[model samples]
Target: MDMQMARIGLFFDGQAELQRWSHQENIFERFIIEVLEHARVPYQMIDDISKFNTVDLLIVGLASENHLIKEALLEYAASGGIVISYGGLELLSQELGCKILPPLEAGYLVLPAEFGQEDPLRYLKANPWQYIDSESVKQTGELSGDDQKSAALLQIPVGKGYVDRWAINIPETIVGLQQGTSPVTEDGIPAPDGTANLDEGILKADDGFELDWEKDRKTTETGMPYFFTPYADLWREVLLGHLTRRALDKGLTLPVLEYWPAGVQHMAMISFDSDMNINEAAEATLQVLKQEDVQTTWCIIAPGFSKEIYEKAKVDGHELALHYNALEAEDGVWSEEAFLEQLEWLKGAADETNFTSNKNHYTRFEGWGELFQWCEKNGIQADQTRGPSKKGNVGFLFGTCQPYFPISLADEQNRFYDVMEIGFLTQDMNHPSLADTTIIQPFLEKAKRVDGVAHFLFHQHHIYHLPKVKEALIEVVRKARAAGFTFWTSKQINDWERARRTLTVSANGRLEVLGAAELPDVKVWIPLADADAEERGLTYKYGLPGKTQVLQVQLNKVEL
Candidate 1:
């Protein structure tokens, strides 16, 4: 065993998966991979039980009733290997001394307050849970509904090791929470909160706003008191933190790649929608960005400002991205062909052949996956349409500020869309009653807490027309700068994320930067079991005594 590192293995049972679910994409498998990938935790996918000895922790996806698989897991646990079970734990219920109750419908996972809950209670969205009851097993969390509360998270002692279990289908629930449980049909989800009245048609992201405004929205110190808890991202952290605790308890080492480059705590991106195509407004917005020494993403509409203005923007290193209009007022059509034509128009208007990102005008999203499909087909690297259009719907209505590839629920393969969706926190920031700092502070703070990008959207017209909007923009830029965040263009952010995904850390502590990728600013921090271990070959770059040691390796040096 490498004393300096602990390898993680995710166990997939193809045979059992085939028997239980007809879906081609093993969502459990994909979910585990996505979680690990996002956390920058190095892991290997292993199906064979013969290689169980290679991993310090084995995550079993959909632990169906297969005798051989159950036996292997039992053997591994007996030998002191940590295991995390996603669902289908009935096979080991008796052996682990737990009673599996009848399943309950969708509810919330009431986690401990230590896991970033502002109040005494924080609930993560959950799919149906087959409640587990055990007096002996340690219960870490519970599934909560109006009339029922059941044991949801359990740490069962199995010989020398432990089986950490989530008594639900975590993957399905996560997918549902992030992508939405239902499709966006013509009959839109009516907002009872009176956020968006989809009278004409349900075409925008706000139509699919899933969170219950009253229950989910948390009160902040500032304006409106509607800083929404990012439930999906928080749930992801809970899983990661659980795994990390177990690994550390077992005296194992795990490396985490920080989200931002150059060791910054978090990131912020300021985006502008060129709605009216007003030349003066555009110029004023550009000047604000320049004065702040920031490069932003300009989502250009058709008949955008003059070619000279775009040229100046391009020259100033701002990202020129398309803002697709699908409203009748703009003579827009909501079709694939229409989307393509507008994209080409923007490319010509900006005089740029390669535009990396886009956001739909009015956030006109019609279907569950069609827009993403169009983005994939058109080589659009990122989309920012999944966010709030109404004031009441602000702050993580999509459940995240992080950029993630949308999963294709329609596809048989359940493929991930190549295009990244970086949902904005809020738009305009010009509400009459609200102060700019009120929204600015909490949104940025929330993004920082989740290690995500604080994306602020301000229309070019609003920046010039609304006094408060300009004030908000300046405040956001200044505060984000003071907090050590580098404002990046959407293209830059997309490029950085894509580049970081290529990096891999091996079990032997050899960090591999594949594809000759050179990311000098990126930081890789490895938590060591013993900071003073003489056998540790890697040089300790950062940490206090008796704390986790970080190895700061330059990616450029390791690039192949």
Candidate 2:
């Protein structure tokens, strides 16, 4: 019953197109890397076949069409290693026991709920894939469509392992969507009235790109104008399924509880945006926090008369973050002089020389890259302005529940923003249609289910003036505590993410920390799945001030 860690290997052929694309924009590999890190899965980018011997799972991209690589992958699968192929790598279709049919020239691919209810892919049923072809194989999963049912995803069991083949070019599809490339019909023209018919219960955008409206509504609605799906969620689901299956097959447990510090299942950050009545609102919020013994962030508008309240909150161990309002600009475009003036005013008003976090007023910014540059230059370590509210909705705008650095799609070099973006998943004003606070529970549930950060933004004025608002805030704290969520400020969340960036775990049970930041006490949890595998050094806890830390845990060896 010994357990073996899963070693994931990604094969890259160094193709010129891939290299160019990597240089220009975010690619599938980047997403894969992020998902793997979040899941604490050890992986390596493999360009040479020599490394195949150490890999338990092999991931091949479309660019990997070399004959030698194909032979290596087939052998690996034959020897009981999982192999997941994306786009290309067509040479092994027959060997993998699946047939790669002609390219499916459809506008979009729909993933019905019936097929993925128990799978991790259930989170992606709301979103549809744009521009997908068809694959012919024994459908191991459910397939739903109007015309002849086709396999969008195929799982074929080969010797002792399996092969997962995706019909869509996922990386290219992501790039096209990011670049605003429109989805077109099979005739190479935009679909009439910006939509095309796939089958029953399927509607796709005429343009090759996903339309915002499609995601705002349900696919089964009248006319089925929209195909609601979360793009990032879909990718994560694909990875999670493969990783989980491999772990189970290897007599190991998937690390499902390692997202937050101290092995906490989830995290919550509460911030009160002081838009009006700063003095009274601040006092009320402070009293509430003191009563609950919780520390939260207070974002006050610059040049406002809230200096005394800000100082009081700081004295109470609450975070005083800048709420940039005076320098609001259109299209995220800002004037340097005006921006600097706002920053200076906030510093003087709060009587603080430096600030670590910010959230723009109304969450408005000219451009993410420009805002990030300004924040970095101004010594702002974190920004929580990026959320799903841009379209005036309450959901993950970036399709991510965790904090991450924003990448500029417009920048030809595809540079990473120097600042951390703690995306706001929910705010008080997000759902104007709701009369009460029922929306909070659903958002919290989603965050906890994914072991993601639940960053909530509430207005101080609302708590003071609106009864329902105060009730909602109370309910949030109660439910979050009941669910074992660690409440953190923006600064704390930023610091944790920064530390995790340099943390690494190897398949051999080596935990390495290369970051220099001072981190809070955290516990790493590794579940014991096998009866014969006794938990040996499965959990480790570390406290502050360590520049670098490494721990070695003894894991039982398992035979494949």
Candidate 3:
């Protein structure tokens, strides 16, 4: 027997002026929705509190000082509806027999061992915690600061339901960690004195690398710049787990749609940047890919291999994309015109009209959100530049192994860019230090833990000139394949992710496959919430022990 799925309602106060929820202030809303979608948790957005009685779980993003919202929340909880809220403690302090205290700027949240978290959670930039003191409030976690009285995680019972509140603003901290604390300025990090071969100032990818070395960076024996602790991903998991537990508490099994198709444990993608664009060099990498029986993405440069070679690659099922060069080549320049020119040249060279993915030459990036905007302007669906370029900066430096749509702090009404960012783990794994399994295995394992894509970048030029690089490429392919990882082109990953976003599960266990054409092989795991599910011939898998048994269903079978 299947239990009715939990209905989640995200309450967004519509009176923007009252709460200052302008485009600038709406990053919280944008990021929270992104997190829910990425986690495959379906939610309905409600602006009015009248609908609060409908959803089983209500996520209050910001209650601000609205007394009406507070009153409605109290009534909903009294009527037995779970609430997860952030901020707005002052209005409810007196009602709940609590006192509000001063908020902290940047702090660490020491999650209790009950949550199975070891390291203290770090919020790079915070939006002021809603410090509260109440004897009735059960503190699951506390702030690791001078103020031992303050609680980081609070669970307060109202009438029948409970309200779980977090002192810190999760959205702001996650946005800051993922896309730098501040906007990327041209003068953010000065280029080396003689490295400026051009008269004009050009921004590179390094200028935008956001992880703080002092607090966030993790060092390894390999001596590579590997941020072992995925701070952003970890915080994301905490929120998801807390939500799942709350659903379970309400006797509902929260269904999470797995990231990869057909419940694949993990997936990997290998992309080769055509630096020299030599026919022989490109063919060399293709030969290795063919041996592994994998289809990979090729980021091609201008004047790429002969048309016949590209045709052969196309026939062999490889994605041909642009390798935007803004480095030292003659066609290289850091201007929109130059970007379009190079993109057009590569498209023509590959005998294609539009390419779905691209990577900047040298991982060249300048400024914030400009490249993403460019990707949107073109037909490009995904980007592969947000990774380590040098040997030192190799694994999880940018703090994620998943493909995500970058949020533009500048955009009004829409903060998220359409183009997806498929960040690679390491580029050119030929260096002796990074080439070792000791360095690579951790990233691969972490991606599996998070159900993220482990992207690896190898250059065509290196594969041809360096025998070590070729050997390393083969080694990674075989190892990842043996580890139950399937290789996909960037286009396939982007297409699948976008299509699955439309998938929805009804309260009656009916799966809605909106993009069935694009999701032929997709699978969904719907939990069997009945106590006697196994006795009725159902199976239990996923989640903790004694959790609900889930049955995997083919997505295409139930078309919306």
TM-score of each: 0.87, 0.71, 0.87
Cα displacement (angstroms), candidate 2, residue 23, comes to: 9.6
Q: lDDT per residue, candidate 3, 1-560, as tens digits?
A: 34567889988676742345354544454577888888778789888889999899998865656788889988998889988865544566666665566666666777866454567777653222332455666776766553545676678888998777777667656666666666555533422332212223545565555554455555456544455656677777777777767887888866666677665658899998877778888788778778878888988877678898788788899998888888854557777888888888887766689899989987777766778888889888899987765554567666677778877653344368898888888867765434444556777777776778888888888888888878878878888888888889999999988877777644455543334344444545454433463464443323322332233433465455
Question: Considering TM-score, which of the candidate structures 1 and 2 is the better prediction for this target?
Answer: 1
Report the C-alpha displacement of residue 307, candidate 1, in angstroms. 0.7
Name the best candidate (by TM-score).
1
User: Whose lDDT is greatest here?
Assistant: 1
Better by TM-score, candidate 3 or 1: 1
lDDT for residue 33 in candidate 1, whole number 0-100: 71
Per-model C-alpha lDDT, please? 0.72, 0.56, 0.70
- C-alpha-based local distance difference test score of model 3: 0.70
Off by over 4 Å in 1: 1-3, 16-29, 105-110, 113-135, 146-149, 187-195, 198-200, 219-227, 431-437, 506-515, 528-560
Clashes of each: 1, 19, 2
Clashing pairs in 3: 205-365, 225-392
For model 2, the local distance difference test gives: 0.56
